[model samples]
Target: MEKKERKRIVLSSNTAFSLYNFRLHLMRTLKEKGYEVITVSPEDGKYSELLKKEFSFFPVKSLDRKGKNPIKDLKLFFEYFLLFRRLKPDIVINFTIKPNIYGSISAGLLGIPSISVITGLGYVFIREIWLTKFVKLLYWLAFRFNRAVVFLNSEDLNTLRNFSKEKSFLIESEGIDIKHFDLTLCKEAKKDEFAFLFVGRLLTDKGICELIKAFESLKKEKPKVKLIIVGSPDEGNPNSVSKGELEKWVKEGLIEWHGFQEDVRPFYCMANCVVLPSYREGIPRVLLEAMAMEKPIITTDAPGCRNVCVDGVNGFLVKPKDVESLYFAMKRMVELGDEKLREFGKAGRRLAEEKYSVEKIVGEYINLIEAVLSKS
Candidate 1:
C-alpha cells in the first residue's frame, strides 16, 4: 500500500480579488480532493494578508489589470516563466487577460500543461481597433500548447476558437454558492422604495454611464425609485468614470453609491431588482448572485448576460448600450407590480439552484482537471 502524492495546481489572475472571490470554491474543492491549490498574482496590501491565511500565495509583479504596458507585460511573462521554473506546478489555470496570454506562454515554455479560462472579452473586443488585432494575435500565440481552453460564454468561444490547439469548453460560471445568497436576506419593508441594484466594476463599458442615464430618467418618472450602486471605480481602466463624477452622483442623490463591498448580500437584500447593462459579459457573477438571492434582474441581451437573464421570465433583457431600452425595462419593472416582481425573483432562485449552483460548477471544473490529467 502506498499514498499517492497530491498534484500541485497553480491558479493565476491579474488581481487577487478575482481569485479570492471567484475561484475560492474551486480551490477548496480541489484541496479537499487532495490537490495542492496555490494562488499566484500581484500583491495587494488589502487582500494579501487574507490570501496568505488560506493557501500558498505567491506575489508576482507582472500584473497590471488596467493598462497595457508592453514592457511590464514582458516582465510579467518572464516573471511567470521564472516562477514556473522555481515552483514547478503540476498544472496551471490562468484567468483574465494578462495571465491567460503570458501565463500560458510561460507554461508552454516550461513544457507544463496549462488551461486558459476566458473570463470575458472585455474592452478590446467591444471595438474593432488595432489593439483588438494585436490581442487576437497574442491569444493565438499563447494557447499553442494549452491543455484546454475554457470560455464563460459561447460568443467568446466562437470569437477565439481558431486560436486554441484543442477544442474550447464552456463552464459558464463555476456556479454560485446558493446558500451564501439565501432568499431570507430580501428586505420586504423596502418595497416602497423599489430599489435597483447594480454590482461589478464601475467601468463605463459595464454600462455604468448608460445605467446612470436610465436611472436619472426613471427617477424623473418615479421619484421614490432607488438605484443602489455597488463596486468601486477602476482608475486603471481607460473606461472608468472620474471620481468627481461618482461624487456628483452621490452628492446629488442620484445613486446610493457604496464603493467596493466585499460582502454584497446587504445590497441584494435591499433591492427589488438587480440590473447590469454591460456591453457584454462572460456570464455575469453578480446577476447569478442576485438570482441565488431571489432578486429579480434586468440585464442586456448580450453574450454572458443573456445566459443568466431570461427575457420576461426571471427578468427582462434590454439591448446593450441603448439607454431607452434600459429605461423602458426599468419603467416596466416599476409597473410589473410587486407580486409579479416577486414571482420573477422566485423563478431566478430556482434557476440558480437548478443551473448554476456551486456544487455543479465545482464538479465540472474538477472533472475537467481530472480528464486533462488522465490523458497525460
Candidate 2:
C-alpha cells in the first residue's frame, strides 16, 4: 500500500521564541503523526536557526510586535497573503496577536482554514484605550472565518464571545513539561535568606511594580528576605519596566536580578517560593513550572492566575495591584514553618502532574486538531 501524503500546516507567531519556547513539542508531535509542520515568524537569528534544525522555517517580513504603525501592519498583511499563496498550507496555527489576526485573515482570503490561540488579552484589555477598542474590533473581524479561537481561560473566552460569531474553545493552558522541571535540590538553601522569586517579563501589567514595592516593604521588617527577579524587559511590551529601573532596584538592595535563563529549573530549586502577581495571565507557566518543581507559589487572584493557586492549599492568592496584600502574603510565607512549606510544595507538585504536563497537553492538542479536522 502506498503511504498517504502528509498535510502541510504552518505555525505563526509574532516572535520566533513563542514557538521555540512553547510549541516545539507540539510541532514534533505533528511531525511524528505524519504532518508536515512549518513555522512562520519574524527572524531572530538564534531561535529561528534552532527551529530550522527540527522542522521547516520561513521568516516573514517585520510584524512590529510593539508598534501600531498602520503602514507596517498593512505591509505585513500583504506578506502573510504572499506567504500563504506560495506555501499553500492546508491549515495555519497562529499564536499571539499579529499572527492570530493578520495570518488568519490573510489565510482566509486564500481559502485556508486556521486556528488562533488566545494566549492572553494582553495590555489591550488592561489599558482599555481607544487603540485596544480598535484592536478588539479588528479581532472580531479577523476571527470571522477562523475554525476556532482557543482560550486558555474562561474569562478571555467569555470576553471575546460577546463580539465574535465563530466558535470558541477553552483549552486551559499551553502546558509545562513536568519531568523537565523536576528538581532534585542539589544545594541547601541558607536559613537566613527567605528567598522570594518572580519570573516573567518585567512589565507593569505583570505586577512587577507592585512586587517590587511589596518586596521593599517586606524586606524592611524581614531583613533577610531576598527578592530574586529572573527576566528581561520585553521591549515589545508597552507596559515594560526599563533596564535602568531594574538596575535601580538592584542598587537599592531591593532585588537580585538574573537577566534571562534558557533553563529556569535551577532558579526554581534555589527559591523557597515562586511569585507572580500579574494583572492577568493565561494560566502562568512560571506557576506551573514551580508547581512541577514542588515549590509554593504566590500569585494574584486574577483570571488565569487563580486557576493554578488554591489559597491555603498550594499557595496564597493576593489582590492584584494591592502592594499591601502582596506584602502580607510574603510575610505569611516567611512566618510559615518549614513543615508547612513542605506541605505546600507537595500539593503544588500534585497539581502540576494533574494539570500541567506535556502528555496531558499533547492529548488536548490531539483532540483539538481532530475536532478541527473532523469539521471539514
Candidate 3:
C-alpha cells in the first residue's frame, strides 16, 4: 500500500486572530483528512505565533483591515498573487473583504480554484458611502472569477445575488465548537445582581451606543443590574469606539469594560444573558458561544442575528439600533426569572447541537470542495 500524497489548501482571512479562533477546527479537520493546510492573514502577534505551532502560516503585511487606499490595496493584491503563485495550492478559501476580493482574484489569475466566504458585510455595507459602491464593484469583479461564493446567511446571499447566485453556498456561520463551549465546563456564577454580557469588537455599528443608552435607562429603574462589556476597540475599523469613551463609561459607573480576553468562557460563566445590538453580522460568534454555554441571548432582529435567536424561544430579538426596544427587552429578561431564562438557554443549546456543530459544518465544506474539484 502506498501513502496518498497530500493536496494543499490555503485558508486566508483578514486577521490571524480570526483564522485561529473561527477556523481552527476546520483546519484541524482538513489536516486529519490528509490535506496540507496553510493559513494566511495579516500578522496578529500572538495569534500568528499560535498558527505556526499547528500549521503553515503566511503573513500578508500589505493587507490592511479597513483601509480603502488604492495603492495599499494594489500592494495587497500583488502580495497575494505572488504568494499563491509560489504555493500553488489546489484550492484557496478566503474570509472577510480584502482576502475574499484580492486573494480570490490572485488565485483565479494563477488558475487555482478559489472560494470566497463573505463573513459579513462590515462597515462597507453598513454605511452607504462612496466606499460601499466601490466595494460592491470589487465584490462583483472578484466573485466573477471564484469557483464558489459562500455566505453565512440568506440575506447576505440575496444582497449580492446578482454576482454570485449560480455559485453561492450558505453555511450557518463558521460553526461553533459546542463541546469546547460546553455549559458543564463552567457553571454560571451565582450573583445578587443580574448581568448582561456584550462580546465583540467595540464598534458603533455593533450598536454599542444604543446598548449603553438602553442599559443606562434600565439602570435607573433597576440599579442592581449590570452590563459587562468584553471586547477591545478595533483600531482599524472606522466605527471603533475610542478607549477614552470606554474609560468615561467605566468611570461613570455604567459598564464593566474588561477589554479583550483570550478566554471568554469565564466571562460567559458570569453573565445572566448575552446581548448584541449589532446592525448585522454573519451570525455573531459571541452569541453562538453564549448559546453553547446555555446562556440566553438578546440581539437585534437583523440579518444574521435573526437567524440565531428565535424571539421568545431561545432568546429575544429587538429592533436594530432601537434603544427603547433594547431597554424593554432587557427589562423582560430581568423580569422573566431564572426558570424561564434557563428554558431559553436550553433551547439555544439544542439549536447549537442540531445545526451549528463544527463537525457538521466541516463535513459540508469538504463535500463542496470535493464536488468543485471533481467538476474542474
Candidate 4:
C-alpha cells in the first residue's frame, strides 16, 4: 500500500510574533500529524531564526499595520499570489488582514482549499465605514470558496454572519497552554508589594490610555500598587500609541512600560492581577496567560473581553472605555487583600484548564481540519 501524501499547509500571518506566539501549537500539532507546514510572514531577524529552526519559512513583505499605502498593499497582494502559485499548497491558512483578505482571494483564484482566521475586528471594521463595507463585501465573496473560516470569538462569528448570512466555524480565540502556563509551581515572592500587569501592543483601541488614567487614579489612593505594561507599539496597527506618548506616560511615573519582552512569564509571576481595558478583543491571550499563571484578571465587558472574565467569579469585568470603572475594579481588588486575590487566581487557573487550554484548542483545530479534508 502506498503511503498517504502529506497535506501541505501554507500558514500566512502579518507578523512574526503572531506566528511565533499565537500559532505555535497549531504548527506543532499539524506537523506531528504528518502535515507539511510552510510559514510566511514579514521576516524579523529573531523570528526568521526561530522559523528556520522550527518550520519552513517563506519571507514576504507584509503591509504595515499602522498606515495605509495602496501601492504597498498591491505589491503585497501580488507577492502573495506569486508565492501561493509557487508553493501549490494543499491548503492555505491565513491570519490577520492582509493574509486573510488578499491571500484568501489568491488561493480562491487558483482553486485551492483555504482557511481564514479572524483574530479580531480591530480598527479596520470599527473605525472606517467605507473600508468596512468594502472589506465585508470582499470577505463575503472570497470566503464563499474557502474550506473553513475560523473566528477567535463568537462576536466575530456573529459579525461575519451579519455580513454574509453564511455559517462559519467559530473557535474560542486560539486557546491557552494550560500546562505551559500553570502557576502552581511558580515561585512566590516574599515581598508584600502588589503588582498589576497589562500586555499587548500599546494601542489606543486596546484602552492603554484608559489603563494609564486608571492606574494614575489608583496610585493616588493606594501608593503601594505597581503597574507593569508589556508589549511595544504595533507599527502595523493604525491605532497603536506612539513611542513618544508611551515614554511620556512612563516619565510621569504613571506606570512602568517594559516595551517588548520575549518572555512574559516573569511579569505574570510578579503580578497580583492582570488587566485589559481594550475597546474590544478576539479573546485576549494575555488574559488567558495570566489566568493560567493563577492570577486574577480585570477586563472590559466588550465581546471578547467579557468571555474571559465571569464578573465576580474568576475576575472582574468593567465597562469598556470607562476609566472610573477600571479604577474601581482595581480598588476593589486591592481591598480584597492577598487571600481573596489568591482564591480568585485559583479560580482563574481552574477556568483556564477547563476552557482555554492549548491542548483542547489544538484538538479543536485538528478535528476541524480533518473533518474538512475528509469531506473533500
Could you give candidate 4's per-residue lDDT for residues 1-376 as a string of tens digits? 9988898888989878789888999999899889999999988888877977989999987556544677887787789889999998888889987788788888888888888888887876656678888778878876876778888888888888754344388888798878778776568567566788899888898888898999899999889988998989977566779989988988988778888898888888888899999888888999999999989999999979898898888789998889999999999998997788889988898888888888888899888877766776
* Inter-residue clash pairs, candidate 3: none
TM-score of each: 0.97, 0.97, 0.98, 0.95
lDDT of 1 by residue, 236-352 (tens): 778888889999999989999989888999888888899999998888999999999988899999989999988998999999999999999999998999889889999999999
Off by over 4 Å in 1: 1-3
lDDT of 3 by residue, 56-87 (tens): 99999998787778999999999999999999
Off by over 4 Å in 3: 1-4
Question: Which candidate ranks first by lDDT, i.e. highest?
Answer: 3
Query: How does model 4 score by TM-score?
Result: 0.95
Which segments of model 2 are wrong by more than 4 Å?
1-3
After superposing candidate 4 on the true structure, give the runs of residues whose Cα lies further than 4 Å from its correct spot.
1-4, 162-167
Each candidate's number of clashing pairs is 1, 0, 0, 4
| Rank ordering of all candidates by lDDT, starting from the highest | 3, 1, 2, 4
Query: Which 10-residue window of candidate 4 scores lowest in summed lDDT?
Result: 161-170
Q: Write the per-residue lDDT of candidate 2 for residues 176-269, one digit (tens) a residue.
A: 8876888675466666788898998999999999999999898889898899999999986678999999999999989999998888888887
